[model samples]
Target: MKTILITGASRGIGRAIASKFASGNKIILTGRNKPMLNDTAEYVKKNGGEPVIIEADLSNPQNVLSLTKSIDITQLDLLVNNAGIAVVEPLAEMTLENWQKTFDVNVTAPFLLIQQLHSIMPKGATIVNIASIASKEGFPNWSSYCMSKFALDGFTKSIREELREKDIRVINIYPGAVATDIWNSVPGEQNLSEMMSPESVAELIYTSVAQPSGTVIEDIILRNLHDF
Candidate 1:
């Protein structure tokens, strides 16, 4: 069975992706919430996948390093950089700490993790970064979040080229606003019913990863039909 590692797999899109892959693969889940991670592990078990849950705060450099050491990266078939954080505030109101924290989780952690794991990754391994439309557009009161995703997109492009010789596929998924707990941190009313469901995004990811070895689905953009 293919071994897949998904960060922030305790909830939302990450959890949905785990469920999609659980019936056939070994899923390694990482998140800061031990209890929530356990819940995801239980779901994976129920779905017939072997689950390995690791509680990690991606913002911590040491934790990122430890995670790589804990996993058998050489045997991994997929790595999903799905962990991220955001701070929604007017540019002037944004704090330095918040901005740094957002980048630490969304950009820096992924960079460090990939740097450590890529060397050991098999030639056909795939790396998927779960980015957002914010990576391509600037949004008011979302400067920190936008910047982090932009950095992530840039990183994905660079690595895709660098790993081309190794035959490792790097995919960046730019999804529109999805109904998740992330919106709880943003101060405003949102049309939850209008947002895309996490399951749709998960299915999109699974489809991209399942493509034949000779083909690569480089990028995918998913938006709610009603949003247009």
Candidate 2:
């Protein structure tokens, strides 16, 4: 069975992805919330997968380093970088602390984790970065979020090129507006009905990872049928 490690696996798209892979593989989940991580582990077990939990706050550099140090990198078949945060404010109103925190979790942490894990990863192993549509286009009040995702997109592209010779697949998934708690933090009236379900995105991720060994789905863009 393939061994998968997913960061931010406590809720939303991360939780859905873990459940999708819970049939026969080993799933290692990491998140800052210990209680939510435990709940996710229980869900994975109920779905017939072996679950392991690693509590980590990716915003802290030391915690990110510790996470990789604790993992058996050689045995990892897939690594999903799904942990991220969004801070919504006009450019003039955005604080330096918020901007740095967004980059710390969304961009820097993923880079460090991949750098540490890629060398020990077996050939044909896959790395998936959960990015957002904001990576491509800028939003008015989403400066920090957009910048972080943009950086993540660049990182994914660079690594994909670098790892081509090694036969490792690096994929970037840009998912538009999903109905998740992430929106609760942003100041806006979201039409939840118009948003895509996290489960749908998770299924797409599962499909990409399940492709033939020789084939790699480089990028996937998922959006709701109707615009919000």
RMSD of each: 1.0, 1.0
**Candidate 1 structure quality by residue, lDDT tens digits, 70-181:** 8854577899999988799998889999999999999988998889888777878899999999999999999999999999999989999998898899999999999988
Clashing pairs in 1: none
* Whole-model lDDT values for every prediction: 0.91, 0.92
Flag clash pairs in model 2.
none
Model 2 agreement with the true structure over 118-179: per-residue lDDT tens digits: 88778888999999999998999998999999999998899999998888999899999999
Candidate 2 local lDDT, residue 113: 90
How many clashes in each candidate? Answer: 0, 0
Model 1: per-residue Cα lDDT at residue 17: 90
Q: Score candidate 1 by TM-score against the native.
A: 0.97
